[model samples]
Target: MAKTIFITGASRGFGRIWAEAFLERGDQVVVTSRKGSGLSELVEKYGSAVLPLELDITNRAACFSALEKAKSHFGRVDVVINNAAMGVVGMVEELGEQESRDIIEANLFGTLWITQAALPILRAQGSGHILQLSSALGVYTFPSVGIYSASKFAVEGFSEALSLETKDMGIHVTIVEPNGFSTDFTASTIQSKPLPAYDQVRTALYSNPAMTESDTYGDPKATAAAILKLVDATNPPLRLFLGKKALPLAKAVYQQRLASWEEWNTVAIEAHGL
Candidate 1:
């Protein structure tokens, strides 16, 4: 059956690819981007099958308004993709208050606003799916991406709590953690003020094989396909990891965390029932 998908940040990168994939499969897509650059071509190609909206998702009011327009235009939104996000790369100290605020506003709160706005629509219909675009860094942080990772980490926690809370309402929520992908994401990333002392670490981070995978950015199309599969599944996992690099790294980080918790179990028990 055909469905309607509302995707934010659809002008480029993963969001654009997902929009195109849905359109190709005959699904109605409500696509929004800050400037609607990529959406223009999609509109030309898919015609009425796609609805392009100019959106700056960081604005809470704008987010609600855009979603309202989407629901009104499409009749109902079966799936909401909270894919609008901006990346910030820098040491924590290097990022000023405004820089931190900018990233948090676009990536974390943007997603929250969309999800909050979409929930009521889905509840009234009694069925819906929400896919949040997190990142591998959400589970495991990387140097220079502290703020970006923090935003994603916030999304992960919010999405998890949302999933648990909405299951009774016939609404599904999934957090998508994708690894490095072949997109303009790196080039488009916002950088914090540089510190001369941090240059060595920053340079090493940028030159790392994982970061230098510029030539081998994972295919967004493949990740999009996996996403569609998750959306269509009867019981999809709460968290979906995309790309080859994400799984092992996430597993390793989680394993290490678990070991530490176990190692400190005595301390935890000692504090309990105090």
Candidate 2:
């Protein structure tokens, strides 16, 4: 049976690819972005099965309105993909307070709002899937991407708790953590603060290499395919660490964190009076 999918940030990147993948597979898709123009083009190409919704997930009223519109169009959403996010790159201290707040609003609170709005409809249907597009930063924090990492980490924790809470409610929650992909993400990324101290490092890490070397990042199509596979599976994992770079990084982070915890376990136990 063809399922109804609602995806945010569908103007480009993983969201767009995921929308296309589902449409190809005969699924009904309602793709949304802050601007409707791009999504309109996609709908024009793909026809009615792909509905374009103009939405800014950061707005609570807009989020609810989108959900209502989706429900009206499809009756019920079989899957909800929360892929809308904004990346704030720079040192936490250097980034303006407003920038940090904006990142949280877009990446964390936006996801929460949409998920909350969709839950009731999903619950009424007895079964539904919620997929979150997190990142490798969700598990391992990096130097310049602190705010982005924090948002993703919040998403990781939220998804984990929600998965457990909805275990018996017939609603499935999954988080996809993908490494650097060949998307406009890096190019379109917004830098909250320009620290002169980090100029050389930033250029060396983000700019210079891209110009000298051929891009070897994972393909968005592959990521979309993986998403489709998981969505269609009989039993999907609660958390899926995607991409070649992502898997190893996640494993290493987990192992290192575990070792650190074990090293301090004696002290921890003593503190607890065990």
Candidate topping TM-score: 1
All candidates' TM-scores? 0.95, 0.93
Model 2, runs deviating above 4 Å: 199-216
Off by over 4 Å in 1: 213-216
- Per-residue CA lDDT of model 2 for 88-187, tens digit only, reads 7897667888878888999999999999989989999889999998988898876689889999999999989999999888999999888777888764
Candidate 2 whole-model C-alpha lDDT, 0 to 1: 0.86
lDDT of 1 by residue, 51-166 (tens): 99998888788888988998899899999999888888789879989879988998999999999989989999999999999998899997888999999999999899999999
Candidate 1 to native Cα RMSD, angstroms: 1.6
Clashing pairs in 2: none
Clashing pairs in 1: none
* Residue 164 alpha-carbon offset, candidate 2, angstroms: 0.9
